[model samples]
Target: MGPTPSSSNDRSERRKRNAKTTIQSLEPDTLCMIFALLDFFDLVRCSAVCKYWNTIINKSKLLREFYAKQKQNSTEFSNKSTCSETSLKTYLEELAMEHHRVSLQEGLINIDQWKGHSVGFNQCRMKMGLILTGKGDKVMRLWSLESYKCVEEYAVPDTVPLVDFDFDESKIVGLVGTRICIWRRNGKRSIFPSNEGTFVKGLCMRYNDPEAVVGCEDGTARLFDMYSRKCSRIIRMRAGPVTCLCLSDDQLILSGSSLGSITVSGILSDQQVATLRSRITIGGIKTLCYNACSHLVFAGSTSGYTSCWDLRTMRSLWETRVSPNVVYSVQHLRSDKSTLVVGGIDGVLRTLDQNTGQVLASCVMEGNALSSSQNTYGATEKRKGRRLSEGTPIDSIPKSARPPITCLAVGMKKVVTAHNGRHIRLWKFNS
Candidate 1:
């Protein structure tokens, strides 16, 4: 129908409007600026707007570019600052490195069947291939490397064995009641602290001298002279119930107490150097390992956290949640100490990078029935029961048998882990 001239003019005026913005209307730079300004949620929201925005969002390279620009901006801003944060650069690399080493993907080690679970549970240490163990409280045995057979044994009923002990190439020193005893291949020597009632909690041997330091349950650290068979000196600590001790050469000693305080003191004199605190150590420190090359101190606490400190400044470099259960031991296996071997009450073994405390590899150290015949089929189900493809789990395999790993000993081509009770497992490395 034909409209009146006045109505037609009004309709035509209403139809005439300004041009609206469209997906193709924006420039690349403008679109990137919008994306840069959007948070993750907003970016996702933009993806839902239309097919044009969805294509750009799916590129993913754009988000990476945005991050690069932000990092560049941070660098320029830091250059103008008077002071800088030392740990800021490290924070950028907090994401752990992913290592797809074939050994780890495959099986890392094979159990020596002949030596399988022969020795009962005991406190043990390994040097070279020889395993030094304290059996019960009165006997000690050195196991052979290849055969896992006991080559030498030492015992003294008069010397009561504590739950733990310390050893070296030649001798093993143990805490018996209030007295500390040193046993060798042939004879035995004992040193009695002044207070027989004070329980010995930790022991550290001085390599250069015939002396060792003992930390007592009463918060006192005593130096025992192995040659003189007497107490040398006692260093007092305000932190109660000394728990662990680590010797950094003959001159310097580090002691951990029940309160989560670590004190650095001299072995010869009572001169105290520094104390590194964990703020509140949920479970006093259970174990400590020091890397001389990096000058990094690693302490494992009962609370299942592993913390590393730089020795130069006495500042903690980093802390990481290592396990859900108590961490029993931490040891540096590599010569460069790029990674550490950690054993915990959770029955897990983790290989973590030293610099960032990033876990590079992990596996269960619990019960397994792998034998010489079974290992021929490999560890995982990659070749066993998979349907001609990798990355698939086998429904046939059962769970691992587990108990807490109390100690660990790593070699050039082997790793030995001890149970808290009386089981020891040996693993041989391929390459």
Candidate 2:
């Protein structure tokens, strides 16, 4: 009953041929559907399996279409449910470690210092290797990090305390009072509709679109088209006096209000997507930052609490208490996605691990206490109608109070924080 060796060999070949024929007969759509689940490397290997498979998977149009659908599905699913805090923490930790490794490989250095300044910092921006500081002075100061010197200062007329400023790829744009000013690299300034609103609280530019989102104290968000210099869309926030705004990668606009509430809206469709409420009763929401890569949104409260929300599932992720004093500003570091820098009225600059909501480093300004005591003494003397000895200028407050850290921004290689003292300090982090 034994078969011949030649027959056995031929049977094996026939089986192999039939399997190949079965794979080749699959519709291209079916094949692509299966391929979509695999990662890039796996897809590459699958394309090399046979000519039929290669022809389908390697086609540029097919690959694009497949990935687009996959992305849309992923986004929809992410919005459906929030990931657990435990999972997010672990994921963030891994991301931080990876960032550190990359930083080391590139030989980057992280620097921390108490750059002497009296007033609190309001906002900061970095562009073309230059750091720009915006403060309550209604002036923007430029600093050269390489030279470690204050280079120049641009003054704004009738300054109403610079709230926040953002730099495009080319120029720096600042929101002074209710006006938006564009500053060229050469220090030239141009104001847009100077007499329009009362105050500008937040600004955001769409990642792919040439439009910027501006939030005002009037409780409305306006979309400005950069090319046409026109308002394209206006959105109404439920909680008026929008304190902060952020735009997600998919063009979803998130705005936090003075009422301690967050509202999410779609930019293209102009629809109210979701609303997020905080657990702690605080003064108001002072800041909001979105991490598109992790699908997370962070909202900072005036009471020194920073809360994280899962953007995908519209659920609260976690919350961490920061300074005892009010948190005026919060900036997420891109170099390490897990790191968030919080500036508080307590005059402390604290670095937080976003994953666990843990404080990693705390820098205190040595002169803040002395400055406060001096202010108290001066105030008492003034009440008594007596001229006290000369006290330090309010701008000379030490770096510790971390006051007026109203704005924080990051660049490809550095981080910048601006204070009310008209000072901007630059920091670099190591791998």
Best by TM-score: 1
Pairs that collide in candidate 1 are 121-422, 367-401
- lDDT computed for candidate 2: 0.61
Q: Please provide, for model 2 over 190-274, each residue's C-alpha lDDT reduced to its tens digit, 9 standing for 90 to 100.
A: 7766434333454432222466678866777888765565667888866477767888889789988878889999888889999
lDDT per model, in order? 0.61, 0.61
Per-candidate TM-score against the hidden true structure: 0.63, 0.61
Backbone clash count, each prediction separately: 2, 22
| Model 1: per-residue Cα lDDT over 1-431, one tens digit each | 88999998988777765557675788766786778688643564466567778777656444334333555654544442343333332322221111212233234545542322234554567775588766553666677775566777666456444545666677777666566666775655544545532445544322334766676677777777767767767887545766777767437678776566688887667878789886445467888878787788888888888888877788877778777758888886534447677878766666677888877666553243443332221222111111112322322223243357777876544556777445456655442
Cα error, residue 89 of model 1, in Å, equals: 34
**Model 1: CA > 4 A from native:** 1-107, 113-122, 135-137, 156-159, 187-209, 279-282, 365-400
lDDT of 1: 0.61
